[model samples]
Target: MSLSYENYLALEKYIESFEDKRGSLIIILHKAQEIFGYIPEEVQEFIGECIDLPKEKISEIVNFYSFFSTEPKGKYEIMVCLGVKCKKKGGYAILKDLEQELQIKDGEVTKDGTFRLKSVNCLGACGSAPVVVIGSTLITEADTEKIKKILHEFEK
Candidate 1:
């Protein structure tokens, strides 16, 4: 997607707000992502120029973090926890069910762009094992049937 003039202006304003500009690359990138939805090539290049860092370095940081997305994500991001507690509580089964029902594997966005499926290490809610996070809502003690109902809520 083409970067709008207003977005570039906003990013520039944010960069100029910082005096030191040291140890702010991640923050800048986060702001850029917030502005652009995802850090496209143009945004990356713009950040590189603003921070005087190589695009490769910026790209590396972006790629290393699961929170950062190079591509636009779905409106609803579904994160299934696969940590030990969750796995023991049938997290993998839940993930497989979602993949089958949505016809999209992990790290994939559905064709309708309504949902993005991802498997995370943990959601830090072990007591609520087998949790599935949809956007900011947490589905504790998640099961296949419960997941279907929750997905329908979003589909509507």
Candidate 2:
């Protein structure tokens, strides 16, 4: 992992923010993610060292929380809603189409590192039904063609 000195400094500063080790793990992990996108095993090990905790504790917290991702995410995260409402309204086809178009499975970053495909339970917009959220933009009724168009807008 070999984090940069700046990142190391940032992590140290975050570590100092909380006096109680057990209470601050989540906050420290959140800052770690902010500094380093997603937390990898190496980062978790370093965090464990900082908190005087074992890697298993950190891994346990990361795995239990959906907000924490062990894998790397691309610059753009494409999430297709698979909630009860969206799924019933053709969400599966939309998700499958995204997987095919992106050439990657759910929760995987693309080879080019431009996009990551993911399935979400809900986006809080069931009225839109079949929603596809790319970055911060939410598209309603996202068919394959519409998904293509939306992705095009974010291409590097």
Candidate 3:
């Protein structure tokens, strides 16, 4: 679902707060995701309009970033790390356990709208290689039991 023009305009005002020298695009995109729940193509276009950049340029930025998602996400999105370090550290096993428990594949949302499972490259937490990020919160060294507890919290 897309926000109305008025709401998008309001988001523009909100995005302005994130404009600074350091990684402004990523910050704005995060804010947009906070507002819209997902970074759809329209949101990218709106971001471009707000930042006075072309849609193509914004699309490029979106494509370049693995953190940004163009599709709708569940209320609690579960991001599993599958980077080299993470994979070698049992991250994939944790993800497999979660997929079996949730009965959903990677990149798919459950029918109940509680969770969406996604495999991400890295969380920059190589020390905590088997990391699972629920929404914006990171859970390092998460096992199946820990993941279950986390999902229970979201269900409530």
lDDT of each: 0.89, 0.88, 0.83
| Greater-lDDT candidate between 1 and 2 | 1
Please report, as a residue range, the 10-residue window in candidate 1 with the lowest summed lDDT.
18-27
**Error of model 1, residue 120, in angstroms:** 1.1
- Model 3, stretches more than 4 Å misplaced? 1-69
Instruction: Residues 1-156, candidate 3: write the lDDT tens digits.
Output: 347776687777887776461358777887777777678888888788777788888788777888777777888889999999889988999989989998999998887867999999988998987899998889998788988897898899
Give per-residue CA lDDT, model 2, range 71-134, as digits (tens): 8878899989999999999899998888898899998988887899999899999998988899
Best by TM-score: 2
**Every model's TM-score:** 0.69, 0.73, 0.59
RMSD of each: 3.9, 3.5, 5.5
TM-score for candidate 1, residues paired by index: 0.69
